[model samples]
Each structure stands twice: as C-alpha cells, then as structure tokens.
Target: MRVLIWKDGENHLIFNMLPGSGPDYNSVVELSLGQALIAGGGFSSWTYRSGFDVSLPVYSPMAAQLDSQQIAVQDRPWVVISSQINIHPEYTQELAHLAQEHSELLVLEACPSMQSSNYSMRCRGDEVYHYPQVLKRAKFCLVIRGARLGQPSLMDAMAAGCIPVMCADSLVMPFEDVIDWKRAAIFILEENLNSLMEVLSSVSDEHVSEMQVQGSWLYQSYFSSINAVTQTTLEILNDRVFAQRARTFEDWNLPPNPLAARSPLFLQLTAPRSQGFTAVILTYDRVESLFLLIQKLAKVPSLNKILIVWNNQRKSPPHSSMIPKIDKPLKIIKTTANKLSNRFYPYEEIETEAILTIDDDILMLTADELEFGYEVWREFPDRIVGFPSRTHVWDNVTMHWKYESEWTNQISMVLTGAAFHHKYWSYLYTTAMPGNIKEWVDQHMNCEDIAMNFLVANVTQKAPIKVTPRKKFKCPECTNTEMLSADLNHMMERSQCIDRFSAIYGYMPLQTVEFRADPVLYKDTFPEKLKRFNDIGSL
Candidate 1:
C-alpha cells in the first residue's frame, strides 16, 4: 500500500484501480504515499495512514507583530508558560501553584489568558501584552500542544528568540527530519509536567542564550514565511529521494558541529600540507622592518615562497634590484588599494594550499617556531594555526562580545598577524565569508585579523591553535605611530568588530579551547643542543 506515486523510476511501474469515483478505496490508500504537505493529520483510516515519514505537518501561517525585524541580544530571567487558562485547566493550576511557590523563578505572566490566581497582576492590555513581547522577556517558553495537533505558539516563541520547551510529547514539529531541533529546543514528556519547573531551573544563562540564538536562526531560515516553509518541505522530500545530495548537519546548523570542523565523514587533511607553506607578509610603509621580517622568514627551512603583499599603493615597493636578495624566491604584489583584505585575495600566483599570513612589523618569532607551527598545521589542515591568540568573552552587562586581550589558558581565535591557514580559506574569505565583514574591515582599516578569525571559526567551528609562548608580539626594536593601535580608541573598535561580526552571522560562531601546542622539549632541563626548537620565545 505504501509507494512513491510521483517518483520517477526506470522500472516505470504502473497501478490500475476501478475507474475513478473519487478514487477507489484501495487505490486511494496507495496514493496517500505520494509526496504532499498534508494538514490536519492526514487520514484516520487504518488502511491509508500517512505518518511524519510520508507527509509534512501543515500549520496555519502566523507571525508575531514586532516593531522592527532586528534581532538584538537580551537577558531573559524567567520561565514562561503561555496557554489559554481553558486549554489545559488542571496543568495550568499546577503550573500556577509552582509559580506562586517560586515567585522569582516563574516571574511574569499576568495578562488575561495566562493570569494565575495568586500571581501579581500587571498588563498593558488583556493579552500577554503584545504576546510576542512576553516571549522576548522569557528565557524559556513552555510549549504544550493545544486541543489541535499543531499550535502557532511554538513558532511564535522561536521567532521572538525565546527557547521553546517542547512539553507536547507526540506532536510532529515542522521539518523535524531536516532540522535538528535538539540544538534549539528542549523536550519534555507531557506526563512529566509536574517536573517542568525543576527542568527549566537546571539550564544556565549561557546555555539559554545559545538555545535562543539557535531558535531565532531556525525560524528566520526555514519557517519565516509560508513560501519558505513550503520550500523547506519540498527540499526535505528531495533530500530523501536523493540522499547523497542532502546537506550535512553542519551545513544546516551553519558552523562547527562541536564534534569536529568537517564531521563524521571528512577528509583527513585537504590543505597543501606536504609541501612547505608560502609566506605572505603585508606591509604599508615600514621599509626597514619589512626587509628585516623578509630576511628572517627566508631562513626558515620549511618555507616554499615569499609573497610581499605591498599594501602601500602610494609608493611602489623598493624596486626588485633594491629588494633584498634571499635564499627563497621573492615576489612583490603591489595592490590597487591599501586594504587589509588585500592580503587575503585569492591570487592566481598562490600555487600552494597553505599560506602563512604574517605582518611586516612582527619580528619576534624565531625560525624554529615557524616550522613547529607549520607541522601543527599539517595535522589540522582545516584549522587556523599560529603564534598570536585572542579570546571573545560575552559581556552580560554590556550584552555584547567583549574582546579580551589578557592572556588566559583559553584561546578562541588566532590572529592572522602571524598565523598559518589553508590557502582555500583565502577563497572563502574573499567570496564566502557570511556578511559585510570584508567590506567592514576594509572601510574601517581595522580588525581584519578579527574578521579573518571569525570567518575561519565560523566555517570550521573549531578554535585556532596557539603554538609556543606569547607575551606581546610587538617589535623588540622601533615604534611606528602609523600602526592601527596608535590611538586610545583602537581597543574599543576591536570590541565593536566582534559584536558586529556576530550580528551578521545571526549567532555567535566563535569556539574557545584551553588547548595550546608547545614543542616537546620546550621546558626541558636538557642542554640547548637537545631541543629542536631552542630559539622559540620563553615558555
């Protein structure tokens, strides 16, 4: 009785039934298997039942009325239940009693439909005070199914960036197969309604924030409009028929899977790891420091080629004859504009898969340290591996991503000022980075390192690696007033970049790790000759 009717097959199978009188009973049973977005739980008949596997749930399209579509981060402190008092009277009474017992925890819901007998009464109007506004205020929304199978509240809660607690056990949610709801929602059995408060209490504010972000992203991507919902349903069906073509879980989630950057089935190492890496140095006007950096990098045994990204458009780089001759073949790329992003442009000359993105002024790193970082990169080809590191901490008080520079054991990003990443990332940086991050970095003439880190972490869902010890990576010798951090406002601008990048991504994609890679004999008592990386800056 179950078969794909609209499906194309080389076998060309056909079915015949008694000439249609609104489709014969047995024939109709067979046709139920056709691809369709059926509403009202298609068929109660024993012979012709369609389940979640064969049909998509069709909820009446409804949206929350908000003044603006902008999704701003907010602190939510209470667990809210929004069901009509008549919908589930007994459960409502139990919830009301629970709220009364733990006043601060249950907090607000004083509007007419959700008003409890003992709870304080406060409302702008009879409703949940614009309904969506109440959801925005709540940390978790208790989603218990109403008299019907589908409810509009679940979508509404997610649309407002409120994490939904799915208390409705057997109800099939929209796009259940394609969307990993566990990432955005919590599931609780209806029989366990009494323990609702206990469950909601256990979730921390950080976790609550992440779930809300995920929920909002899911709503906007797949369920924002009726057309979008319909398209998602069809795409799910198409993926089922052509399983190989289906997007991976990471693609659907849009970043690192927390398991691995590439996931269950990924290539071991795709970067040009076997060959030595190309040294890409960006410079503006620091002629002496630029030549000194080039001379130092040229001595590294693992270096393949040297590309001087001469960002100083006003003056062409010291002529080829004037350029210092080195052991490695050197090429100077004179750019059209003085953009920080120019260093990441995927040029035709880049033949290798791994690129070493370092700045002209960074001269503290030793040759041994560069080799060690390249070796680490070979093992983790898809990650950003380098010397300098930075962390992005969520500032609850400011409600934004705070750029933390104080050294800690943890690292979320490795600055490109002296980092090695796969050349493939250059393609993504110029073409596929999520938002206006490239343009932003170029326009401001700042935070290009942060923007590059965000793009890599966003795609890899993995934290960059920090090798060797790092104090400050500034020049041991001269000072330049033209440097990006010459003013008091430079630090503040970097902090704002983190917040802006996260906003464009729709969620925070940066991952932090307490992991650091050091040379095997880095801190050994053995003689200087015993250590391969003896010149690495003090641990």
Candidate 2:
C-alpha cells in the first residue's frame, strides 16, 4: 500500500492510494503536507528534503478512484517503524536498540544525523522506495503521537492490515464511540516505553490475530476514505438521536395491540381455586429473610401457592419451623446445589397459570405490586412482564452494551421480580434449556434473569413490557450485599446470547416502541405490616 499526500493551496489537503510497483516499493508515506501542518506540524527539515513531488493530476475524481482500490494485506511478521522526525528522542533511541537486539524488528530513522549507537542511516535516493516493502513484511506498526491527536500513521497501519501499537496516552482515536479501539489496537503509555518489548511479547498469538482481523474490518467499515468517514459519522449521530428519542418516549406512535387482550390463563386458576399466581422465592443461607418473605406473602389473599427454593450447598436442616399458618398454601423445596438457575425449577409444579419469581431478600414488595404484575402479564401472555426493566443497545462500532431506561413499549431485559405466563416458561424449557442449562449453571452466571428476557423476546415476536411500579419497593437486606466474583461472568455470556440471537434470527434483540399500560392498584389487605425481626430464631 502507498499513501500519496497532495497539498491543496495553503490549507486544504488530500490523500490518495496507489498499488505497489514492486517489492522494493512496498509502502510510501508523505508527511510534509498541509494536513500535517494544520494538525500541529512536528515534521523535521529532513522530511521536507525527502518528500517527492508527483506530476499526477490532483483532482477529486482521481483521488476518489484511488481511494476505492482494495487494500492489500501482506503476511508480515516483523515490527516496522518509519519516521523521519524524532518526536521523542529518548523513545527513538530505545527503539533503535530494540531493533538491534531482535532480528524480527526493523527501524528506519530519517533524522538529520544518526544519533543512536547501532542505528542505520536513512536510505538514500531510490533506496527509499523500498519503504513499502519493509512495512509489508511487518506484523505491527508503531504509531507514536507527534504534535497532535489525529495521526494519519494509525490509519496507514490499519490500511495494510498491520496491528497498530499506539504510544499516545491522551490520544483519542476517530469514531471511538462506534469502534472499540482496545479490540483492534494496542495502546502503551509513553512512560512505558522501557518495557515495550515485554508488553508486546505478552500478547498471545490468538489475541494478535483477532486484533489484526478487527483492525482491517474497522478500516473498511469506517475509515476507508474521507467520504466513508463522513458518512459513518453522520450515521452514528443519527443513531444516538434515535436512541435518545426512543428513551424519552418521543414520537412513540405505535398503536396498541388489540390482540393483546387478557388471556384466561390467570382467571381460570384463580376463579375456582383462588390460585391466580404461584410465587417462587429463591433463598441461599438467608433463612431469616426467607421466613420474613413467606410471612409477607401469607398476608395477601391474591396469592394461591408459595414455593420456597432453599439453595444451600451445605447440608443444613430445613427451617420449616418458622412457618406460620396462613390462608395461602405453602411448600418448601430444598436443593444441595447453589445454582442460581434453580429459581426456574418451580415451572414444572406451577399449577397456577402465571408465576412470580422474587428474591428472598425483597421485604418491601407489597402484595399490590405482585397483583399488578400479574395483571400486566395477562395482557401480553406471550411476553415477559415485570418491574425494574432495563433497555440495552449494542454499539456495533464499540462492541459494547449501551443501557437505557425502559421506554414506552421496548424493553431489552427485565428483573426476575416480574410475572410471566406458564406458556412462556414452557417455551424456554423446550427451546433453550435441553442441552445448555448445565453449562450455564456451572458458569455461576447470575444472569439467568437476562438470559430469560432474551429467550422470551426470541420466542415471542414481541418485546417484553416493563410495568412501572406505583411506588418503589425497598430491599433493606440486599442494599449492601456484594455479589461473588464468579457471578461477574455475565458480560461474555450476555454478548454470546446477543450473537446467537442475531445469527439465528437475522437481527439484534433490541426492542423498539411498544405499549405500556398503567399498573393496576389493589387495596392493602393486612393492616399491620409484617417486618423482619433481627433474630431468625425469634420468628
């Protein structure tokens, strides 16, 4: 690959690309131009002396034609650095020493005079044409910051499919919001120059390969030419506006689905047996909290059955002695495994049409909220309905998740403190659970909530509805609890879930404008609120 710098007037500048003529003419870079000057010129006098004047016509059509040419990637293994000016003399000297110590490394110093111990002088006359050849055989290209932030050398390295080693600590790459620089490039602080070789060697071959591929893809997608960059920038701005508007509930005009009439699922169970919903509580070592939660449920007349899933890895006696007689029927199921996914085990025994999954520590959740969630679930029986909803948007450029508040109709995920119909549970059991549940449990991924939301959207052709709570519920016991380190492994798994859904369904699982109805309020039944006692034995 060859970079042709064209100076237009005294300010404007343009760049063009040309195919390599021969092995000797591997890469061409010209820096003594207006663009470099406007970007805080740091070029030395030697750079101007080495600059070549091309008689080729300088016009927009010709430049566009050249930029459209395919970038040629070479199988290179050496690390190449070609700079006429020494912006950081100390770092340059160390690089020269490194080249001498490593056979696979090459350094081309084009200063006024060679000041290093074993540095080779810049190639003279036509020998300089072999610059591209040296770059072609290099696996990594060193792009040190000069006088400014935006450096063309970084783009040059990416164009040749060479992994860029950025040495500017404060430099922010172009299109950063849309592109994750860490995945495509390596960044080292200027102060870390002494250990540059060690740092380079630490990167595994697989990681290097992935970076190279991602760098090439990024260049083609966003940095191929000035026009391409401009178009991508506009698209990014538009996307941000679209996301913000969606979150603010602006221009949300989707008609309510008349087909979303309440299903007979909940009414059928509660009509004869007064068992509208089954409440599943997941507990682990928090026996006191579990007993308090059960007591709260016993006060609600709407609750039909309660299932307490005791998940204590240690063999401990059941705490059934704390149970107090109430109108609602109660059952306890104990498991030796501490799998967080055990919250879903009650699906098989859920005689009620709808199920409400709640954490054992949520003490302030009133019976009204559960009943409201049940009403919302009835309208969208195929969709998961819950409180505490979150919307996630995937940034293609950065390869990261962007979260937002649950909008009118679109919800990316919902917390387990929600209600869903039994049919949705069966859908997950049949589609995503057969062969994958064990691996998920073994990973200690506490993202079963996130996974269930994704699966619900995948199975149902609609986004989940997040019911807004009339009043906030407080979980005093859960306020300061820290999750285990093993539970922090959800990011990778969530990304995988998004990838799988996109691959199978041909689009991302981002929910857009959907209708959200106001939560129905029910009168409180118990005049005296049940509170958690300090001692578990006292209960």
Per-residue lDDT of model 1, residues 392-420, tens digit only: 89889998889888889888988999999
lDDT of 2 by residue, 126-220 (tens): 23423333444566778775543334566666666678888866544554444567888888888886666778788877787778777767777
The C-alpha TM-scores of every prediction are: 0.52, 0.42
Collision count of model 2: 7
Residue 45 lDDT in candidate 2: 26
Give the top-scoring candidate (TM-score). Answer: 1
Report, for every candidate in turn, its global Cα lDDT versus the true structure.
0.71, 0.56
Clashing residue pairs found in predicted model 1: 256-461
Instruction: Give the runs in model 1 whose Cα sits over 4 Å from its true position.
Output: 1-274
